[model samples]
Target chain A: MARPLTLYYAPFSRASRGLWMLEELDEPYALRLIDIRKGEQKRPEFLAINPAGKVPALRDGDRTVAESAAICAYLADRFPDAKLAPAADAPERAAYLTWLFYAASNIEPAVMARANKWDVSAYQASWGGYESVIDNIAGAVRRGPYLLGPQFTAADVILGSMVRFGVSAKLIPNRPEFTAYIAHLEARPALQRAIKIEAEYVAQLKT
Target chain B: MARPLTLYYAPFSRASRGLWMLEELDEPYALRLIDIRKGEQKRPEFLAINPAGKVPALRDGDRTVAESAAICAYLADRFPDAKLAPAADAPERAAYLTWLFYAASNIEPAVMARANKWDVSAYQASWGGYESVIDNIAGAVRRGPYLLGPQFTAADVILGSMVRFGVSAKLIPNRPEFTAYIAHLEARPALQRAIKIEAEYVAQLKT
Candidate 1:
């Protein structure tokens, strides 16, 4: 048997992107859900894996990778068959890589600040505040159907995941631009599978 | 002649990382210093190139890459002769890619929040607040000399830049572990040259 890849995740958390990444890749992996509500993630054992005490950490063979975007980046590179990540020399790779870092570095943080109503100067914040981020993202997708032109790569998976979170949480307004972008990626079969899995997980939590 | 790589830089800003990245690669790149103090980065021409109006944006060939870490990631892959990034299949690459995203995605935001004294909860913040970000970084470096075992790749250029920013800004204290880790990377000649250049630029401003 292959050294099984394991992801310590929690539904509806950032780890959903990691889970969704694995789902998109069609890879064999085990989902080890860490219950944040019950304080399971804070346990010593969990900290041993990720001192940050966050989900979306992955145990692949002997190495471990954490952070949602990081996990997705790793998976894209690790599973070359998925072609989720562009090759090093591909011109499209520039936009692909930029969007990957941009999502986590700018979009996520800015959205959090916006929802919390923090008084940050949009110009000072790397993400340029929530509205600027929305504008920047809209401008990118308006250029094409996906971030990297026509390719619906892992960058989309991560960005789409954040977009969905933003919409559902009402942090990102339901602007026609964002809706259209999400609609484009949500139409993918692999993404649908991951959504179904999360819906089931959410239902289980309710019952 | 080589569609010269140009970095839109500003002394003491995140652009220093982009400069250091080019310096480390031994690639000749033009420095287009944007005087953020004079609001040059916000100039219509500059904004036309990068709407974020941030320093440390890069124009390589016909491609433009913004976001400090993104520029570093792009250069690492674009100019592979530098050996800054690991092969796609290398196990260490996972940790490498993870830390690159971590620096920009978490450490930068968390440090900014701390320095500004933003009334943000550590738990709610995406970077998990300042202290957690510091602790997590310490744990990663504690494992080895670098985030990716022994190799000093482009990941170091980005992370080292942030570590230096953190300690200098007093946002991240002069913890012995951090100081030691930075000492390991700060000893590099390329970094030294970049620092010297920034110092020169700062001196010019004084006059």
Candidate 2:
């Protein structure tokens, strides 16, 4: 029997990354949407599930997973038929891990810094200067239509979500490469479906 | 033949986490120590391997994995026989993924903020303030002998490293739980072995 998966998510939060992955995998999951505006994420019940009280927490049977990148990696590995990640022993697995962590550690922090307008000393910051991170990302994207080249893996899902968010927030300058990459990712049927569903959810909340 | 694994590292850097994991794996690996103070990580040759110029980048054959947590996860998955990670299909895998990402995303950032004495609105920060991050960590350890109950996994390597670093920097309070946890982790033969080798490297460089 397939274990049931429950995702505690909020619309337009980082949880969307995991939602997109679930769509890509075509897995049956129950989306228990928590409204961050209502302070639902800070409720004691929610805190028990994730002491961090962040959105996009996943529960599979008795196990709960938080952190968008970790959730995505876990799903990809658990559903090997999706092939969203390389096999553990496959040589490509190293690159797979590299990009996955890079998306979270490098790209995410860089975006946050830009969004918050935080002044960070590049020498002490692990992601280097914001410009360096941006240049590195552009160089990587210039290498292909996807982060790992032709084959789209789970890294693309997380990276795509981040890029899309950045572009929407004007955090990433509207460069030709950024525009093309976002378009390429949005063209994915799974992402389109996820976005559509999220849009409907948002619309429902508005009414 | 097993694929070659090489770690680009320097003693006392965050890369020590990767070195500790390599020792735990008991796998044959070449350690190419890069002295950060000498700007070796910024050299063109090393830059080609990791433009991020971070220590603890792992090269497995033609593929390179960076970010200490990512490298730890990759190695655990790559050498499944080491049982450093929960089985991909196991529900506990979610817990493993959660804490692993937590170490990087939450703990690392919090430590940096504390170390740099950066003051920002905790509500505005995604990490939910250093106090919360520390509390969450202490809560997790108090539930321990390990992050994942009695079973030690790569999450421990990641968390253990952060805990040790945090305590040393006085970022985390030296409470009994924190002290005990660090002692438990440092006492591990693998960590001891890595530390011993790193101390030797540091001492050699001094002369």
Candidate 3:
């Protein structure tokens, strides 16, 4: 048997992206919950898995990968049969990697700056500014049924989760493009399964 | 002959990471300078290449990849003959991709938060905290001649650039590990070439 895949996860956290990715991959995996509310993620044992002490760290037997985008990218590439990512040699792979990094590199930092009211100069910040980041996502999704046209790769899982979370948190303005994009993602059975699984986990935690 | 590779670069900007990556790949790529100080990067023409309007956007034939880490990842994967990254099927690829995403996802944002003195909670921020971020780098580099141990991969280029820039700007503490890591990277002939090319460009701008 292949090494069992395990995801260190916590609901109401960025780990949801990894959870959604797993569901989309339609792969068998074990979810090890880390309770962020109880500071369980910050505990030593958890930190051993991911030095960052964050959830969504995926362990495949001996190897562990952290960072939400990285986990998604790793999983996508690992299970090429899922067709969740373009082949490495494919021409579209350039744009594919770009959007994956863009979600973490640009969107996350820009959102943080905006939410915190940080006065970082647009020129100085690698992300430029919140408006530009949002605008770029809006433009890309508008041009998309997916980020790289018709194929909904792992880039969508990473970027879509960010946009969905941002709009829900009121951190990102609910532009028509974003709303339409989120609505489209909502229609996906994989995402629907992810949402249900997350709700079930959250419900279990409360009781 | 393969299609030409072009680096849309700006001196003293994040584009230097792309330059270093290109040098490391040992590939012939044209450098297209964008003067950020004069706001040439903000021009409509440049924005068409990278919606973020940032430097270090790399174009391979008809494809353009932006974000410094993304550029490095793309180049490393596209030219796998250089062995700058592990193959998709290689077990080492998990840690490799993790470190690539961690550079942008963790290191950059943490540095920005620290520089701005943004009052984001350590737990709330995806990066955890500036201290943790720096500590992780220190711990990783101390365990390495490179991030993934002896084999020098693109992760080194992305993370090393952040740590090196961080130390130079005094944004990151001058820990011995960081200094040593930067020193090791400094010894690279590729990095040396990139630095000389950047200096020449900056000198020309002055003249």
Candidate 4:
């Protein structure tokens, strides 16, 4: 039997990336929404599940996985039928891992640095300052309509969400490439479904 | 036939983590050490291997994988005989991925922020600031002799390297847990071998 996938997520958090990935895979999952405003994510129970007390954690049967990027990679591998990732030994596997790690290591930090106005020395910082990171990402997008050139892997789920958030947060300028790239992602039915579901869930909070 | 693993590495850099992993795996690989001091890493030929112009890039035949954390995970998966990772179907797999990502996402950035004196609001920072990240890591270490408890998975290779470097750099204080953990890791034959080889390589450069 395929194990059940449970996602402990919340609105307006990085959990949205995992939520979008779940929607993309069209897998059956129980969404245990933890309200950040209500401090549910910090509760003793959630803390037991994730010591970091962060969202987008997955409970695959008895096991739990945290970190949005890791969760995305795990689910894609777990549910190979979704074709979210190339086969483990596929030639493209290397590129897939590269972009996925880059999203967490390079893209996330770069976004945070820009969003928080942190000053990182260009020589020491791995991302080489926000401007360089941004240019690197831009260069990647200019290479294609998708991150892996043609096939949209699970990397797109995280990277796309980041680009979309960057656009909305005004952290990344709406250059033609970024704008066009986001449009392509938004047009996906899975992303649309996830966004709508999240919007409805968020709306319920007010009621 | 299994493909030859070509590792682009440099001693004393994050590439050391990959070298430690290679030792742990006991895999036969061709070591192409890039002299970072000679600016070999930034050369156009090296840039083709990694646009970031960083060391620790692994080439498996035609496939290339970069980023220390990614390389660790890739090797763990590729060499399933090593049993260095939890099976993809195991619940502990999530925990495995979590620590690996956390090393890159939370710990690395937190250490950099402190080392480079990048000032930013902790709440606004994705890592929730260096203090909290360190506290979280210390708390994790308190859970064990290893990141995943008694059994040292590839996550240990990733975290152990960071802990060792952070302590040496004095970015992380040498607390009881930190010191004990480093001592435990350093005692490993694989780690010792890697360090011995790197030490000799560095010594050669001085002559």
Candidate 5:
């Protein structure tokens, strides 16, 4: 028998995004908690798995994938039965990928800019600055129940996590569309389970 | 006959990254220039194609994909004959996607942090700081030939463009690996063509 797919995770961190994805897949995946609070992720042992020494690196067989969006995109494609992603030939695939990249490439930088109060010119920053990024995101969520309309895919897992975190932390604008979108995402049983799992892990760490 | 896949582009801009990928694909792709210098990308007409009002939005049939990395990933998968991406089942696919997201997510943000001289904490900014990002990049290119061994995929287009830009601007370290990698990438006829195309476009604009 093959060893189960595993996620190198840490509770309350970006790794939770991967945790949510794993739950959504509803597949049996092992969790190896890297005590980020103790900087376990930066340790050599974990560094071997991820050179960047970041948590949320998913290992399956001998292959390991890091970067939260990449992990979600990888799993979604690897497990087609889960229907967490569009088929490569599907028309929606282009939009699907666009959102995934947008979440990471555009959203994250914009969030950081806002947090750090950086005076980033729109031209200099490929993300086009925080206000435009939020406006684009707001426009995206406003059009639907999800980023790519009716069907929810891993793009949501990637982008939704950022929006959810941003909105909750009072960093992203508290627009009605975002609030509604967060509510919609929060209602997911998989997300609920992931939240419970993180809480449980944190509880155990505390004990 | 189907309309040729169109790339909404701006010479000497991030869109050039998409142009390089299109050239690498060696397919008939139409270029619709959105002059960034004239602020054409910000116009409502261009915004209709890409809500973010950014150039490098690729339009195939009715589907339009933006974000340079997304466009490259989409094209690579869309045209498998180009061999610009690993097949979904291929072992390298995970790493391919990892690098794609890494270039966009990790690399771009790190570049911004460096250019702006922002005091970004590794914990907060998530690119792990500019030094670590460069170290990781240098390590990858040092392995040589290409990002994923012998196969040169769209990951290179996305990341290479950034690395090339960084090195030339002296923003990235003057490491031997990166310098050699840029030289290797520069030798590609497709990149040369892309460069020539940009130069020609600029000349036309000047006239």
Candidate 6:
């Protein structure tokens, strides 16, 4: 048995992506829910775990990995048995790293900026707003069922969940490429399990 | 000889950091300067290299990798002889990945948000703003000369450049920890070469 891990998660937050990744890894882990609705994530104790006070923070033994994409990348490498990453020196590894950071540094911010209708100038913004962010992803995924093609990696989880949320929340235009890419993710049994588990967790919150 | 690589860089852009990384790797790479002031990044030919129209894009052989942190991480692993990354299965590996993603996903965006004074609600913004981002990095670096301690990695390059830019721009506070961190980074030989090269590139624009 591996060292036990804990994922401090919230159903409605980006933690959903972390939980989805956990399910995809097929590893034994514990989930401790942080109720974002009640402002539980901002509590003192939770802030100690993540000063940013975000959910989807994972603790492996004494080490803590926060930020959703970081957690996903760490888990992929830690559980290399899952083979979600290419070898360190593999040629494919460069694109894998590029897409993961792209999602974190660009896609997430662009979606939020668009979702909130923030006043952002395209040239001034690093992400250049939602249209091009979407365009970049679509241009790549148009070649694939996966961002890396042929093999599903953690990059897929990052891109798939972000696009899924954007489409579902009506923040992103329902383009054919995004629509099909999200549908492909939806069919994954791991994502289905994550959805089911969160439903149970959220239902328990009401009682 | 290793495969020849090209760095599509611009002096005023974040591409300076990418050039820094190439210098750190101590490998020979040709610098193809893209003049952002002339709107070169938005030009048709440049768009073919990075459809997002971002600088700091890299072309290794025929594969293209954009995003500075991603490029740093890729080059670090690609040239493992540089000893910039922890061994794949090392205990330090998770923290290594965590900091790299933190720089891209958290520190970089946090600086931009603070600099632009975006109206970001703390909980809604994944990066939690500049103060918290600085706090997180300070907490880690106060324990070190580098993010992972006693040794420098590509992650330091990312954090170092961002803080240097942030403090110089007066966007990030020049606190004890940050000032000390920037000073430590300035003492690095690789960074010195990057700065010298950038100055030369900039001087050419005036002629």
Root-mean-square deviation (CA) per prediction: 1.9, 2.0, 1.4, 2.3, 1.2, 1.9
Query: How high is the lDDT of residue A156 in model 5?
Result: 95
Docking class of 1: medium
* CA lDDT, candidate 1, residue A183: 84
Q: Which 10 successive residues of model 1 chain B have the least lDDT summed?
A: B121-130
Q: Pick the candidate with the highest lDDT.
A: 5
* DockQ, all models: 0.73, 0.71, 0.85, 0.70, 0.87, 0.70
Instruction: List, residue by residue over A33-142, the lDDT tens digit for candidate 3.
Output: 98889989889999898887788899987888999999999999899999899898788988898899989888877887889888978877888889989988998899
lDDT of 5 by residue, B1-207 (tens): 755699998888899999999899867878988888888988999999999988889999989899999999999999999999999988899889888988899987787788888888898777888888998888888887789978999999988999999888888988999988888899999999999999999999899
Evaluate fnat for each of the predicted models and list the values in order: 0.75, 0.78, 0.89, 0.73, 0.86, 0.75
Q: Per-residue lDDT tens digits of candidate 6, residues A1-207?
A: 545799999887889989999999978899998888888878999988886677889998888888888899889888888988887767788788889989888987888787777777777767886888988899878877888888889999987888898888887778899988887888889999999999999899888
TM-score of chain A of each: 0.93, 0.94, 0.96, 0.95, 0.97, 0.94
Off by over 4 Å in 4: A1-3, B1-3
Indicate whether candidate 1 or candidate 4 has the larger TM-score: 1
- Candidate 1 Cα errors over 4 Å, as ranges: A1-3
Model 6 stretches astray by more than 4 angstroms: A1-3, B1-3
Candidate scoring better on lDDT of 2 and 6: 6
Cα distance off (Å), candidate 1, residue A197: 0.7
iRMSD, model 6, in Å: 1.6
The 0-to-1 C-alpha lDDT of every candidate, in the order given, reads 0.82, 0.84, 0.89, 0.83, 0.89, 0.85
- Per-residue CA lDDT of model 4 for A93-181, tens digit only, reads 88788778877888777877777677766556666677766776777777667887888888888777888998898888888889888
Residue B93 displacement (Å), model 1: 0.9
Better of 2 and 5 by DockQ: 5
Runs in model 3 deviating more than 4 A are: A1-3, B1-3
**Better candidate number, 3 or 5, judged by lDDT:** 5
- Of candidate 3 chain A, the 10-residue stretch with the lowest lDDT total is A1-10
Q: What CAPRI-style quality would you assign to candidate 4?
A: medium
| TM-score per model over all chains | 0.94, 0.95, 0.97, 0.93, 0.98, 0.95
Tens digits of lDDT, candidate 1, A1-207: 644699998888888888788888877888887888787877999998887788879999887888888888888878877889887787777778778888878887788777776778866676776777888887877766788878877788778888888887898888887888888878888778888888888887778
lDDT of 4 by residue, B37-92 (tens): 88898799998898777778999988899888889888898888898898887767
Q: What is the lDDT of candidate 3?
A: 0.89
Expressed as tens digits, the lDDT of each residue in A39-119 for candidate 2 is: 898899999999988888988878888989888988888889998988888777887788788877777666677666667
Summarize candidate 5's per-residue lDDT along A25-110 as a digit string, tens digits: 96888999899889998899998898888888999888889999999999999999999898999999989999999998888788
Worst 10 residues of 3 chain B by lDDT: B1-10
